[model samples]
Target: MDVQPGPEREDSHVDSDVSASTPLRVALLGAGVVGGAVARHLTERADDMAARVGAPLALVGIAVRRPGRDRSDLGVDPSLVTTDAEQLVTRADLVVEVIGGIEPARSLILRAMEHGASVVTANKALLAEDGPRLYAAAAEHRVDLYYEAAVAGAIPLLRPLRESLAGDEVRKVLGIVNGTTNYVLDKMDTSGAGFEDAVEQAQALGYAEADPTADVEGFDAAAKAAILASLAFHTRVSGSDVHREGITDVTPADVAAAREMDCVVKLLSICERTDAGVSVRVHPAMIPRSHPLAGVRDAFNAVFVEADAAGQLMFYGRGAGGEPTASAVLGDLVAVARHRVGGGLGPGESSYADLPILPMGDAQTRYYVSLDVADRSGVLAKVAAAFAEHNVSIETVRQRMVPDERDGDRHDVGEATGNSNARANLVIVTHAAPDAALSATVESLRTLDVVRGVNSVMRVEGS
Candidate 1:
C-alpha cells in the first residue's frame, strides 16, 4: 500500500539550514508491534524521508524489555536492540514511543524531551492521564511532542483537531474508537451471535485480547475519548472523567431490535461541548443504520466531528495492528524530523480552555430500553406511565408476544425460544432526556410486579 503523507506535510517547511554531514539519529522505545513497524518504516522510506527533511535519518538504537528477542519482521539489525532504555533516549535527536500505558513510557519520553530531542508517541492512556505534564515538559524543553497514533491508529484525527480545524470551533467529537468492541458488536448484529459468542469469535480472530475486559468494558475507548475530548475542547480530561458503558450487556435480541428500528448497535465514544461544560463518554449506542459511523464494521474505526466551519467531518480507517499504527507514528516522525532539521517546532501547549467535565447525569441523549414483562393487560400502559412520570418522551415502542412451546407452533420458533415463553419483550426508544430521569424511570419500571426484567438499556445516537 502507498503511504500517504499527513496534514503536516502540506505545510511550508522550516528555514533552518543544517549541515549535510549530520545524520538525524532516532531512538525507538518498545520493540513491540508498533515499534517494530516504525523501525521498518524508517528503513523502507529512508531515501524519501531523508530527501524531504534534507538529511538522512538513522535508527541509532531501540529499547526493548528483552534485548535478545528476534525482530526479523522489522528488517533491521538485531544488534541495535538494547535493554537500557535510559541510555537510548540520550543518544538520539528524536525519539518515538509506542510503549503503551503509563509509567516508563511517560518517564522515558520526558527524559528524551529534557535531552533536547523531539518525541512522538502512540500512547493514548499516558496522554489522557498525564497530557498536561508531558505537554509542560515538552514546552519546558522547547521540543515537539506529537501523538497522532494515540487515538485512532491510522486515522489523522489529532492533526486535524490541532491544525486543520484550528480556527474552527469543534463542538463535538463522537466516534467508534475501539475496533475490538466494534468488531464484536458488528458480528453480533450481522451473524446473530450473542455477546459472549461474538467476543469469543473476536478473540479467535485476533481482534480482541485474551483478557478483553479493557475493550469490552469501555476502558480503552474511554481512554481514547478522554484524549480526543482534551484535544477537541482544549481541556484536561482524564480517563476517570469519561462515563463508560460496555458492550458486554448487549444481546442478540437488542441487535435484532436495532435492525427492526432501522439502526445498528455500536460502541460509541462521545465528546460534546454543552452549555454546562464538556461531556465525554463511551457507551454502546444505537445509531441509525444510514449514519456514517454505523457503516464502520469489523475491526475498523471512525471518528465523526462537528465543527462550526467544517460542519461534519468523518475520519475512518484501521484503528489497530502494527503496520497501520506505524504509519501514523512515522508520519509524526517525518514532521518532527522536518521541524528539527529546520530549527523549529510544532504548536505548543493547548490546555488554554479549561472546560469542566460534566457528570453523566447532566449529559443528555436519547435511550433505547428493552424490558421483559408478563403477557397481561395494562403492562404497556404502566410502563409508559413510568416514562411519563420522569418526563421521558417516547419515540417508538415495540411489543411482541412470546408463545409457550406447549401451546402450539409459534409464528417464529427461532425468535420466541430465545426469551422466556411466559414473558413478552417490550422495546422502547425514548427522546433526549436527562440521564438521572432515565435511570429513575427504569427504576420505577423495575418496581412493577408485572415487569420480569430490564433486558437492556442502551443510548441512541445519530438519530
Candidate 2:
C-alpha cells in the first residue's frame, strides 16, 4: 500500500548526525491500523524522514496486545514487537501511542515523559478525560506531548489552535467530528434508510463498528468536543463536562420535517466561550441547507471555527480510517523529531484560563419539537399557551392530519388519546431560548390532556 503524508510532512527535514549523536529512535504502542500505518510511513520514508529531522529516525519497537500475531506487513522486524508495553516506552527517544482507553495508554504516556521521551498520541478519549494531568506530567518532565489527531482526523485543528491561531481569541468551535454518525445520518436523509439499515450498511463498508454505541450515541463526538473546548478556550474540559444527545431518536418523520424547513440533520459537537463559562454539547441538530456544514456528507468531517481576528473559518476532510489517521500521526512525528533535533520544544504547559464549564440546562439554542396532539378545537391554543407560559416563542408551526386506519377497527377518542397515528402531528420550531425554559415548556405540554405524545425534540443549528 502507498503511504500518504499529511500537510506538515513536506516540511520534515532530517539532520546530519553529530560526532557522538545517534539516530532518534521511536517506539510505537498499539499495532492497530493507525499504529501500523505510522510504522509503515516511517520506514517507507526513512531517508526523507532522516533528512527532515536532521538525524536518522528509526522504528525501534512496537507494542501489541497480541504479540504472537503476524505483523510483517507493518515493515518492522519481528524482534521489535513486544507484549510488554511499559518496557517498550523506556528504550526509545520518543513514543507514539495509538492504543486507546484510559488505563495503560495513560500510564505508558506518563512513564515515557518521566523517562525524558517525547510523546505523540491519537487517543482522544484518554486526552479528553485526563488532558490536564498528562500535560502536567509533560511539563514536569519538560518533554513534548502532542495530540493533533485527537479531534478531526487529517484536519490540522489542534496545531492551528495551539500555534497558528494562538494570537486570536477563538469564540466558538462547531464541528461534525464523528464520521460514522454523519454517514448514518446522511444515508437516512438521502436514501430514506432507517437507522438500523443505515448502520448495517456503515458496518459492512467499514465505516462503523459492530458495537457502534460510541458513535451512534454521541460518546465519540462528546470526547472530541471536550478536547476542542480545552484547546480553543485554553481551559480544561473533560468528557463528563459535555452534555451529549445521540442520533438514535431521529426518525423518518423527523427527516422529512427537516427537509420541509430546508434543513439537514447532522450530529454536531458545539463548543463556545460565554460570559457564564465554556459550554460544550453534542447532539443531532438541524442546519440550514445553505450552511457549509450541511454539504458535509457521508463519512467525512468538518470543523467550523469562529474567532475574533479570522472571523469564520472551516477545516474540512476525511476524519477517520487508517491512512487519514496515520497521516496525522506522521505529521506530528515529523514536527516532534525536528523539535527534538533542534533542541527546541513547542508550547509547554497549557496556561489554563480557569474557565468554568456551564451545565447543559444553561445552554441556549433553538429547538424543533414534534408533538402528536388531538385534532380538537382548542388543542393548538392550549399548546401555544403552554409555550407562552415558559416564555418560548414559536417560529413556525406545521400541522399534518393523521390518516384514518383502512381496516374496520373503530377509532375511539380513548384510543386516539395517546396514539401518534390517531392524532395530528404538530411540529413547532421555537426561537432561541434557555434550555431550562424549553424543558419547562416540554414538561407543561406533556401534562396537557390534548397532547397525545412527543415524537421528537431536536436542536436547530446554523439558523
Return the TM-score for candidate 2, rounded to 2 decimals: 0.91
Identify the runs in model 2 with alpha carbons over 4 angstroms from their true place.
1-21, 404-422
In candidate 2, what are the lDDT values of residues 235-295, reduced to their tens digit?
8899999999999989987888899889999999999898889999999999999999999
Which stretches in model 1 have alpha-carbon errors above 4 Å? 1-17, 404-423
Residue-pair clashes per candidate: 0, 12
Q: Ten-residue segment with the worst summed lDDT in candidate 1?
A: 2-11
Give Cα distance to truth, residue 418, candidate 2, Å: 20
